[model samples]
Target: MDPAKLSNAIENVHRAGMPGLFAEVRDGDEVWRGAAGVADLSTGRPVTADMRHRVGSITKTFTAAAVLHLVDGGEIGLDAPVGRYLPELVPGERGDAITVRMLINHTSGLGEYLPYAYPSLRAFPDLAECRPQSLDDHRLTRFDSTELIEMGVTAPAAGAPGGTPGLYSNTNYLLLGQLLERVTGVAAEKYITQNVIERAGLQDTEFPDGPQINGPHSRAYEAFFGMIDPPRDYSVFDMSYAGPSASLISTVADLNRFFGLLLAGEIVHPSSLARMQRTVPIVSQEGKVIEYGLGLYPMEAAGGGIFWGHGGTTWGAGALSMIRGDGGRRMSVAMNLQRWNTLDASGRPQPHPIDDALAALYRVAMSG
Candidate 1:
């Protein structure tokens, strides 16, 4: 496929409804970068391919790699019980049954803590609900990791530990962060920065210290499923609520570099990479099916072969990165606006132009 096709696809995305978007695609030695749309709708400032953006849950891969570093050092066991290391946090039979592997793979059968943290999101039976009003309520509130983890632990178990079709939960990643702190004698973010981010040679990625972005960055615009008219900017909001699970800020280029190096066995050993690529049937927060691995997932391009990567989203930002199995091709994309779809009577997102445009863009980006 021609790079122009991908460029046009990005333009189509903005025209379809996205506020702004930037993307990078790689084919062996050939690379292409493009941006289309505004960085700030208020000022009409354009977005660039190199600007830093919140990569959201893509932070999970970094966290997983950091944990694997300890695995490579023979300091942590993948199947070890969480209770053995963090009894104070996970405690009792439930903790003993949930292994580190379960935590990373999200088969620990733990519940989500989002609804508990942001009460407006609670749907009663589970924490798998979302409410835009809650986003405004907690914009500046800093949440502690332990507090979040307990919400998941105390909630009724989603299923037995290591069960099939595991549930996706931020609580799992927070536990991983606690595990990292236990073993490394430092904050999880510190260990990951020193090990995974630094080792990947990613310069723009970091666990932000505060609500403000450090350098050049597009403002994050979220619609909360179109509940907020004209969308709202959450660019300066604190991310501590999601810390290890979804707080890392990065650029598209850095994301491509990280995934590329990860697949090439530069950050952790090849065996560790193999473990990260192992996928299982899992249910996402949106109740969608995803082939989730330790912190990675597979996206099959149209006849382009299997690509392994991850997609992440914050309140008003979204990003996805993918690389071929052989590491010869890749694509990393970021967008400023999120959840542009409005909900109808069924509580499902009504069809919108942006959704189709984003799908088309990915198809072109990953085309062979």
Candidate 2:
């Protein structure tokens, strides 16, 4: 691949007000790794490939793998009703019928009930409506997992038949996190760290206890719901605020390493990995796109190739991790700017540089 085109592409994305963009492509050896823009706009610290950004639901893949490992070991059964493992969280009648497999596949039909889904119900009303708070602020970093669970459990469900067959909810994974801990007798973070992260050797990656984003890294900011330009500072809004389902931080290189090992059958058993990727039909704007697999998403790429990976977006950060169908090549990108415009007729969004960056990165990586 031409280095000039790559540089130009990165430059264009940087100019669009993203704090920075970093990408790493792996093919037997790490290839074409680069970073651009400042980690902190105020301090003018240049972005580096090592700086961490939250990976969002990509963390789901790890959670799913942990559950499957237990399934493969005969400690848990995918077909067994979830109530057998977590009776408290599972409703009586519905609990007996819903299996663990349904939760991983988004076939559980549990409504997504994120407390942050509504701006009005926030725990700290003053902090809730504020645009983007600086990470340095004391009131913001105080957010933690306990508060997250409290808000989540009380939030309303998306539908009635809790585990019917067609809805995606973070609560399913949250429940999975709790179940994994129950079966293993270890916290979910430690279980995944020992079985997944440490096994894969991801040095810079971490799953903090709550939603804290304290580190020597880029300052995360977001484009508010109605705003166009990126806000000055959102550091005050920590991943700790979202807890496990949404709070994982990592770098492009670390993410690429983790996903590469995952698909290569290094961290998970082959049979279990196979079960994690099985697709199911679901309702969509179009007739029906593919529903989620275990922890990953199996989607058709812009260039007409099916890839397994996941994308995570918080208020400010956006993460993309993908492994080609063959699982031999992978590409990962992490950006600090979040843009919300819809893709045009060609499935392209120009003003939002992420769309272009994603397309070009996909083209080059998928070419192999």
Candidate 3:
């Protein structure tokens, strides 16, 4: 790999508006690591490759893998109704109709709970309402999992269970966390730690239960609902609101290791791995085409071929990890900024800087 070009790419990412960015790439037997910008804007702390950050929705990949481990062990069934495990939680006709596979693949039609629990710009689709002050009051609030699930369940379903045109809902994985607990007699975090994190030999990844990140890490920051305001430090906010759906904290190195093991069938059975890679096209609320599998996404590579992984974003952090389908290459990138996009005065959408950064990183990571 050309360090000069990679360094220039990092500089470009910094110029794009991220407070800081870090990336790790494994090309065959060699590994390349890079970072640019500040980890803490107030202190001007430089970001390092090993500094941890919230990996956000990438936690779903771990949750999915844990659930699949139960499936592989015959403790749970993919096609089985989630009602089989938590009949009371799901309950009645709706419960019986929704299957484990539907939840993992996001075909359960479950509505998201965040908007209902905390009305913020993230819940609103219009860019005009995405103001920084919208979420300022609830930054320190914590939510119970049961109440969060109830918020989603009481709302109308997104579509019929097992229906076509799947909608992405964090509620699906929230319930999956409940399902994992029901079957394993352990919390979702513990199960994933033993089965996925440890199995992947990841020392820097964890599902945190509190607002504090327990190790050396970059402070997370967000532009507050994508509004044009000074970025706020959100590194200490509670993640229980996200639970198993989006709260895993990790470094790029550990993320790349986890994806490498997952894609290589070391974390789950090959049959299960194959099922995890089976994908369906999803049209985002913004009308972009995304191919989603159980917990993985099939992103087009910079050069040619396909890579499988997931991207995650929280209030003030963002992460992306991907591996070649054939397991020849892998990369993980992270930034200490979220809601980085906003609308111009003309109502046109301004793209996030990470878009350009990832494009550059992908070119370098996927090169021969």
Candidate 4:
């Protein structure tokens, strides 16, 4: 397909009264990148390939790589109890039940909402106000892993150990982040920057400190309580609370390179990379049978190719990333608006418009 026509197809999505977006497709040595919508709609800034956006759970892929690096170094074992690294994590039911692999695979039977439950804690005027959380009340906002684990102990387990698979949970990755820090004797960000991001030659990506999107970024919009126009207040979507579960931010180009290098065995030892992609059964969100590998989600696309990547949703962001296993191609999309629960008048989540746009991009990438 001609790049111009492909670009027109992506831009026409917003023209169809859906939403404007920026996208990029890379093939072998050829790269076609373009942004066709208002990035910062508030100020009319146009989207660009370099514009940074929240990667949400896509950060897990990096964290998993770091853990596997330590494993390659013989510093940690996959089936070893997390208690071996962080003794504090061994409390109540989580004491002997959770292992390093279980945490990464979300088989640890931990609760899922300890991270997102903050938004439902107080009656908010809107999702935006709940996200950015005003400075005056900042002192009251803190999400500690210790407390999160304790909360999980009380909630009903998704299933018994090795019983059944569960969806993605921030608690799983948060524990993995702590375990990585413990074994490597380095901060998660530093280790990731040195081993993963820096090694990938991604000059445009950085781990952000909080919820706000800095530098050249997409126009972040919010769909709160199902209102389509915009969000009322976005004060509580603090990224700090997210920690390693979903704190990293990057551009589409950086994400593409990171995924490519990761799957190619450039980031970790060969055996470790093999272990990282090794998968087990996990429940599918769309009722499409799928498998959850170490940090990646392996799902069959409509085109009949198995793609490996992750989708992320934060306060006002919805993101999708995927790469074909054979190194044929890869695609990633990020939108500034998100609504996890609230639905449109026709009764659907607001982020679906952007999600569909991302799927379209994946289809084009696979067409090659």
Q: Model 4, 112-134: lDDT tens per residue?
A: 64424454433232333344333
What C-alpha lDDT, on a 0 to 100 scale, does residue 212 get in candidate 2?
A: 52
**Per-residue lDDT over 1-368 for candidate 1, one digit per residue giving the tens place of the 0 to 100 score:** 58778889999999998989999998877889999999999899999999999988999999999998899899999999999999998999988999999999999999989888988888733322556688888999999899999999998888999998999999999999999999989999999999998888889989999999899999999888777888999999989999999999999989999988999999989999999999998998778878899899998887658989988999899999988899978899999998787877667778999888888888888873
Candidate 2 lDDT by residue in tens digits, 268-308:
89888887787765443122455667777786666577788
Worst window of 10 by summed lDDT in candidate 4: 120-129
- The TM-score measured for candidate 3 stands at 0.95
| Runs of candidate 3 exceeding 4 Å displacement | 121-123, 130-134, 225-228, 285-287, 344-348, 352-354
Q: Report RMSD (Å) for each prediction in the order shown.
A: 1.6, 4.8, 1.8, 4.1
Candidate 3 lDDT, 304-331, residue by residue in tens:
8898898898888889888889987888
Give TM-scores for every candidate, taking all chains together and pairing residue i with residue i. Answer: 0.97, 0.83, 0.95, 0.85
**Order of quality (TM-score):** 1, 3, 4, 2
| Ranked candidates, highest lDDT first | 1, 3, 2, 4
Identify the leading candidate in terms of lDDT.
1
Superior candidate under TM-score, 1 versus 3: 1
Residue ranges of candidate 1 with Cα displaced over 4 Å: 124-130
Candidate 4's TM-score reads 0.85
